[model samples]
Target: MPDPSLMEQLRADLTTARKDRDKLRTTTLSTFLSEVKNREIEQGRAVSDDDVRGLLTTAIKRRREASEQMRAGSRAELAEKEDQEAALLQAYLPPALGEDEVVAMIRDAVAGGASDVGGVMKAVMPHTRGRFDGKELNRLVREALAG
Candidate 1:
């Protein structure tokens, strides 16, 4: 059989998590699924894999921030739970590009006539979006231009 789409895979995993009574995984999946549903309704169409990935990325970022805040507040247990949820959701994203790989891409863009940060970013963002964090990618692009 053909592989299921990311949405289908996520739903199937949610079912499995529920069956196994894995509380963390179940809560993470349920919350993500709701976000997916909300995005679908907002856009008035089914989400593509890329759209789903974006939503997953946003959810993971939120969890990361919450985890940090919890830690700062001395809620280690809550912080740990947030970290766990973030890690669980992170599994659904595409593998992140390595630093060297992203640098090579930046070099190529620069060599191809992108002399400024804005231009280099415009050239590279399409290829790297969702694969790397925006701030890190910007730093790489700026470093490339500055070098």
Candidate 2:
């Protein structure tokens, strides 16, 4: 299970969001917490810190995909909202690896027998863990491999 303190922090954020009258922020945070609650109930167990991080990653990915689709459909307002929500959600996540650092990591992965894309991902993913988006990493890996 996640550290009790971490869950407490999430609750604190939810309360702050509500108090700030940031409807979008409040809704996004509430939805995230709801998901965590549902998972805990369905599994008959509390979520681990890793599990929560994974869930956040999933939520962020979904929002990013939705934002892309909304943009393509010319739903600028909706897309903007999704983007804002995404930013807020990301704040709770670990700091992301910068492009240069990612490239360096990829290079190290390649040195560790990551000739194939899958191999590279396997090598590097553990290092990233709760930080950085997998899709973004994949793209960078592919580019690094191709060049």
User: Relative to the true structure, how large is the alpha-carbon lDDT of every model?
Assistant: 0.90, 0.87
Best by lDDT: 1
lDDT score, residue 65, model 2? 90
Candidate 1's TM-score: 0.95
Residue by residue across 31-111, what tens digits does model 2's lDDT show?
Answer: 999999998999899988777887887888888899999999999999989888888878877898887888899999998
Of candidate 1, the 10-residue stretch with the lowest lDDT total is 123-132
Among all candidates shown, the one with the greatest TM-score: 1
Q: How much lDDT does candidate 2 score?
A: 0.87
Q: Which regions of candidate 2 deviate over 4 angstroms?
A: 1-4
TM-scores of all models? Answer: 0.95, 0.83
